[model samples]
Target chain A: MSASVSPDWIAVDWGTTNLRAFAMQGGTVVDQAQSDQGMGGLTTDGFEPALRALISPWIAAGNLPVIACGMVGSRQGWVEAAYRAVPCTPLDTVLTRAPASGGLAVHVVSGLSQAAPPDVMRGEETQIAGFLQLNPGWDGVICLPGTHTKWAHLSAGEVVSFQTVMTGELFALLGQSSVLRHSLDPDGWHDAAFAEAVGDTMAHPERLAARLFGLRAGQLLQSTDGAIARARLSGLLIGSELAATKAYWLGQNLAILGTGAQARAYRDALALQGAHAIPADTDRATLAGLTAARRLLREAT
Target chain B: MSASVSPDWIAVDWGTTNLRAFAMQGGTVVDQAQSDQGMGGLTTDGFEPALRALISPWIAAGNLPVIACGMVGSRQGWVEAAYRAVPCTPLDTVLTRAPASGGLAVHVVSGLSQAAPPDVMRGEETQIAGFLQLNPGWDGVICLPGTHTKWAHLSAGEVVSFQTVMTGELFALLGQSSVLRHSLDPDGWHDAAFAEAVGDTMAHPERLAARLFGLRAGQLLQSTDGAIARARLSGLLIGSELAATKAYWLGQNLAILGTGAQARAYRDALALQGAHAIPADTDRATLAGLTAARRLLREAT
Candidate 1:
């Protein structure tokens, strides 16, 4: 597929820990590749080299147009794509030009930022744009579950408001680094424990800090299994998040943009609360968002 | 202070990170010394050597009595000093004996445990015993601030119930290991920011996970100072704790058993809520608790 396809353009999702590039022939993907040289571990000058290393085979000819999104445009990334203030559409037509070599024309998509509540998003904005493009005229809460989970309220094709929660990050830190690490089995899961803990924290969200230490104590006193402890930990963190974001998900048309076990956990949690959330694949949303950005760039030019 | 004193009985406070010993001449501290041989890094056979290294000078003759408290008595320490159930005094008159060398008879103080809520404490029980001994017949809530901050309610001479929060551990992980580390100043302190954040989370404790990501976002969008961010993180964590344990602190005679900046922070946070928490020295409490344990051992023998 790589040798047979002479890509017209490239769709790049360059986030903190990964760099995925898709060779595009018009509206379809011809070939794809990914690398670990994401914005996180690279220096200012390393972006161009990283991109060339991944997509150089597809860029056989000169003057290849490239559309990039996520942290690649962050302040610490290859180039700083300025943040567009929200209460507007997720995508901006005016793409930020990044200095490139090997005859590559790199245009980075801008991130979205909220002023009052002091929230910001880089990679998730593209995913939101893609979700909106895939399901046009959609106006509801779109939840993007990841390391930094985002919940955005959409109205009239615009992001009216949104909030970011560090649930995934908290789970990782607590399960891996905190005293709870000793009690949690990394690969274990218990459905009943998860549901019970979710219900417990949802009802008494203020008791989060108090409840956390119980996981460790449970192991010590009752010999609670690592699987039960793991599930309970996940439930406690997610439950607190759900309780906080009740204004966004309660009685609203919701779609969660993720495809992994984490996404399933969110769905299961919401289901326990009697809310059914439509699942959307994150990769599809990202590609759709980048495609929408590609069209916007073409229209502006 | 070290060479002049030949101690009658030694009081040892061995926790997860530090080992401190006090040379006691019948209820009074003659000389005190400390080492970095905490229980966290020691093997089963290492506890005796660690303890002897620091107090070998004081133990000129064989058969010196030692009363030790904290993690040194846990299942992972020199020996397991079984946890005493609640509705009982913090320290047990019947102490666990660790295998000692050099003609030493080492007695370990028993920790307190709660069955319903599933809580456990090691060293803090000793501090509570000391507080009870010093303040005689004290009935109220005792707050011990550290890695695992404990809040215990006392009625008559028994611990009615207690709760533990990993507020200090959370602060360390979020500030030093999480993404928030980039925006936090290790030594920075902002009194107003701390107070404001404490109030914010106290009123809305469920929003902890949602509010945490804002620290990183605050740094990105607003250039929030490291000091202010650090203080806010502390406020957020502590405020959530206060919210969860409102049952223990509200309208109760409260005393905070700590002397460090962390103890003062708890005091100031409570002060903001118009609740005054009397400050107590932790070292004094430890010594007093150990002395009490010594008396218990004498009576038992």
Candidate 2:
């Protein structure tokens, strides 16, 4: 998309590994920019320069309002933004705003924190907010699949409660770095094996540790193929996640807010358990949520 | 021990990450040798050089038999030794031998394989055999803890059945590489937390996945301690393993054949569930098993 003559504000989704910014004119994204200088890569003071570098061309005359989400608001990010408690409207929640050296007024969307059992999420709050905007007052469960997947219970247009599972990160670690790497197929997936593994783990989640070694043992015994092994590994991990999160999905309208294969896998796994997951693009949801936050700031001013 | 002037044979327990050799004079270990040149670090041809390098000084005039166990007999190792089916005597099970270049009559002990539910073990089989030798006619369960911890059921002086859990490896991966690394205390562990996690997971193993994320969430929420996180990580992994292998431990004389703190941890975890796990040295058991195998071969000859 082409940049508008003068944009309303810059919407930034500053995560751990990637930085994405969208130039917004009124309510639509006019121009987009990205950088690898995520919160993980930058020091305390590097966030502004990274943001400035991305939206330099779009910043023409006056100081532009920048609404950021994700780890950019964490203590490790550019500015330390305190988290908002759950069971509150993410869009309406008090955001942490900080002004950088440049002519930039920045507002960071605070993450949602749970007191019970202790859980927290940053950028996902923005996604949840955007999802809520897309379908106003749609109360159910929105499963946000990522390196750390989040299952949020949405009720009365608020994030009532949510929990996280390190599903994606664990999968990558096991499949890429663990001993089972030799047996698992890196690029293939067997639907049947994945489904069967999911069902097995869901029914008896206690056997997770025992079944994990089966991925390697099966290959040694010549009873399992690479594709099946890979699928089963994924199946078992996700299945265990589902088993822990049965309360969130049972009799609830489930929606998966994620990007690629992992998201599709989540949808498919839930489908097998009689809970069809509605899929949503993470980027779109993030943008919509940021836009809503910007509108709220406008009204507050 | 001292090297015998004229040793009868060499007992070699070669595994994926370690190479241990004990020179046997007559049903006893005389001289000992070891190297980091495990099967994992060598090609097919490198095994001979590695072995010769360690025991060449102790070699006598005749072609001395070298009884080996573990991954050195794996398909990817020195020779593709076939797996011996279980419910048979591990000491009496036929071993595959490769004729090395230096007049060394090499016998590689094949690991035990299970057909039902698909399971296999390489180095641990040797430990099982040795444990049986120490406790003749011991009809109970033997828990061998390591990277791939194994629990074998011995009945009437034979390995009736066994199961493997990636408990050790999983603990290492999560504590070292995963996000939980930041929160978990690398140098310390809390006993109370460990026991609590063990009991919690044993009762409700489904919470393992959720509890895994709790380690990270607790840190982020400032509601968790580093030492407790570390112990809980170990506890959760072991607890899940114990839950799956409950069939082997329930109302059985459980002997944990392993080395170091990990084995002790397993023993303690089992103690919580009313099952007392007797601790045994892994290296001692392996040596005993190799000696017994060499003895059986000599008698057969």
Work out how many backbone clashes candidate 1 has.
1
TM-score to true structure, per model: 0.97, 0.96
In the range B1-301, model 1's lDDT, one tens digit per residue, is 5566667889999998899998899889988889999999999989998998888877866557899999998899989999999989888779998998656889998898999899999999999999998899889999999999999999998899999999999999999988899999999999999999999999999888788888888999999999999999999999999999999999999999999789999999998988898889998888999999999889988
Considering chain A alone, report the TM-score of candidate 2 relative to the true chain A. Answer: 0.96
CAPRI quality level assigned to candidate 1 from its DockQ score: high
lDDT of 2 by residue, B1-301 (tens): 4533567889898888889888788667778889999999999779898999888867845667899998998888999788778987776646787758856789888888898768888878788888888877788899988888888888888889989898888889999999899998887889999999999999898987888988888888875889989999999999999899889899998898987789889999999999997778877888888888877777788
Best by lDDT: 1
Candidate 2 segments exceeding 4 Å error? A1-4, A60-62, B1-6, B60-63
Worst 10 residues of 1 chain A by lDDT: A55-64
